[model samples]
Target: MTQINRRDFIKLTGASAALVAVPSVLKAEIGSAYEARVVVVGGGFAGATLAKYLCLWGDANIQVTMIDKNPNHVSCILSNLILNDRLNMNDITLPYTSLQDNYGVIVRQGLVTDVTGDDVKIVHLDDGDTITCDYVVLAPGIEFIDVPGLKEGAANNFDVVPHAWIAGPQTELLRDQLHSMQQGDTFVMTVPQSPYRCPPGPYERACVVADYIKRVNDGDGHVIVLDPHPEVTIEKETFEQAFNGIYKDIVNYVPNATLQSIEINPGEKIAKTTAGDYAGKVLNVIPTHKSGKIVEDLGLLPVGARFAPVDSASYESTIRPGIFIIGDANDSGQPKSGHMANSQAKVGADAIIRMIASKSSSVDFVHDPARLEKIRTNSACYSPITYDEASFLTAVFAYETTNNSMKLVQDSFASSNSPHWNKDNFEDMFIWSESLFSNSFT
Candidate 1:
């Protein structure tokens, strides 16, 4: 096997092509004995990356405490491989040891109950522990909206219809269920409304499951996809080809199948929706997602909005200047993917360092003309259409002074052609995903 490194990843991801990296070390240089504390609320791709870079780029005065419910983060990126048996939980599990040992970031394992304060922030934990800080970043990722009939089903039985979206024990349950498929058994899955965590994720899951079933059953099992959207969400042509061309006999793609309720039973599950009731041996129903619980509990979300709105240049909450939201929680009009979250963390980290380095605790520094021009972010993701074939997409966005928001650069947008889905791209997917996992966590 060929060895791939982070340098190769930067070139493939193309985030550096738009100059997204800002030198926070420069911010560290101009500070005296001024000390600042940053408390990050979650330790996924967004919060962990912010905490690690804050200590690495900021001066010794930068003290960061990361509070997460778990000591390790199981990445949703490359998790599809787990269903196909190419990878396992250990491969995607990232610990906080490096952040603590190498960068001096304090990793606190607890659930954040409430966050209060204006100039200074106080993070309240469920265990009655509170951490005071100069700035607080909310990167709790996402939470799912309850389906009409899921609560009762879950109460009666555990994980009857496993979504496996967050990628942990639920993921293992879903995989084990897939492994139990008989020769003619059926697997049914749903795609929630748009603006969910990952745009291409549902379709990718369908393909991976179909591929696995074909291999084990010799093309006897059936795979059904129920998507509410009009058509494919992202990389339309590529996924359409995979569904219709490669796995047509085993896969069935149904559009505009709005999910209404679900009925769980001992041997089979049925999804009741506008399209019709689908009876299958296994069910994976991913509900519509919203910002993390903390964002909604703290009243950061605007009226009738699912996510919190923030200034794209710095990712600082418009509702609360000193409080920042990154990853799937923020409404920045960016794709909610791991690569994008890592990029947004860099922008947020740089802005926070600059604020403290100025020797002023005021939050108005984000409006400076020079600071806005330096704002740029990019995202790249590779989706596996089969167990050994993949497709990819890349996009770059820069802060537009006219709109006061980030806009996609038409020239920088690129996606792999449907015809290019081959073995080479499949190999690149593992390298790309592994590199991203290492770069953000390690």
Candidate 2:
């Protein structure tokens, strides 16, 4: 992976000047001879952010059509709060109305069956609609693989052992289950291996559920966290303190525990794992993930890889040009979080705008030094230790020209030190999420 610290990117690129000046210049030329139509698939963080930026940075002449299976995006960012009753589903939901009304983006509700074409892009929707465009940005989030004995549509399937990872109907189901836990009832959840969506997500969910059980159930509730990884993947110290210190009595942390299969029995949840058999009242199994079906169907992913390989600078697929992959679907070597996806979308949107204005015919716009220099992305995640307290971690990545990749900046790497959890951080988490929600949706 090639990268530099965020400061280095700022110093080399004149970041502020270029970001502020270049968009206006491109916006000025949008209607003249540089008009372009761009189709964005998936209405998650990456696609929504890219569509919003494409319209904001590129003037009215640039047409952006945003497509998704759902009418709006239900954010996974703070979905854990739903389980604890701290937040409702509507609290994190974002409608495409803002993107359509505010940014002049055309929001369409449909599934993209196929993305094809070379010079001129072609997107086929499941509803028998085909859209031709100059470029296509795909940010379809993630898809889960079938675990043994737990095929998605089986009679006793995910609806019972809800993953609640995608933050939709499943989220509500899990939230209701957690809310219904009685005193002394056990709640069990599994964490998949790394490189999955949201590195710290499983840990956060464990913390939130544990917190809810203790406070709401009068400390009589039990929370079991089964991990497939050796240990906590991200924010180790903070979550360690959470599990071992505060909720030690109520929470059981099992490391090196690989989930073999799940057999859901009424009021008797059984998970067969390498570690041991765990029985609980509620079971949440987050199975392994792969690139969204759209990207996989397009053959954009390398063999045996869960994500599409792309140029970090422009987010253009290494195998196919003119089609860019962002968010959790692409292997950009960045943390697969909403914040990182939003950051990559900005760089991607800018690159597409520049390419359109330059009249580039080829899909290889990533080799341009000027384009690579301006790419910078930062990711921050705040994990709730309790209902009222939270801990934070942050890192920055910049495009490194020498190796042509994105790397984490050593200096920008920061996390809350000892005594990481605090009420102030909890407050900041909401503010941060609101900013991201607005940037991507409104």
Candidate whose lDDT is highest? 2
> Best TM-score goes to which candidate?
1
User: Per-residue lDDT for 179 in model 2?
Assistant: 85
What is candidate 1's lDDT per residue for 1-442, written digit by digit as tens?
Answer: 1122333544655333223445644554555555799999999989998898888778568899999999799989888889988899999899999889888999999999898888888899999999998899999999777777684422523367888999898889999999999899999999988899888899889989989988888889888999998898888888888889878998889898999989888899998888999989999998888899899899899888988999887788888778999989999998888888888988888778878878665546766777777677767777888778777776767888786788886666667773536676778777777667766777
Error of 2 at 43 (Å): 0.8
Model 2 C-alpha lDDT per residue in residues 266-331, reported as the tens digit of each score: 678898999999999999999888889899899998888988999877888988888899999988
**Candidate 1 clashes between residue pairs 3 or more apart in a chain or in different chains:** none
Question: What lDDT does the true structure give each of the candidates?
Answer: 0.82, 0.83
Where is the poorest 10-residue window by lDDT in model 2? Answer: 12-21
- Model 1 RMSD, rounded to 1 decimal: 3.5
In candidate 2, list every pair of residues with a backbone clash.
none
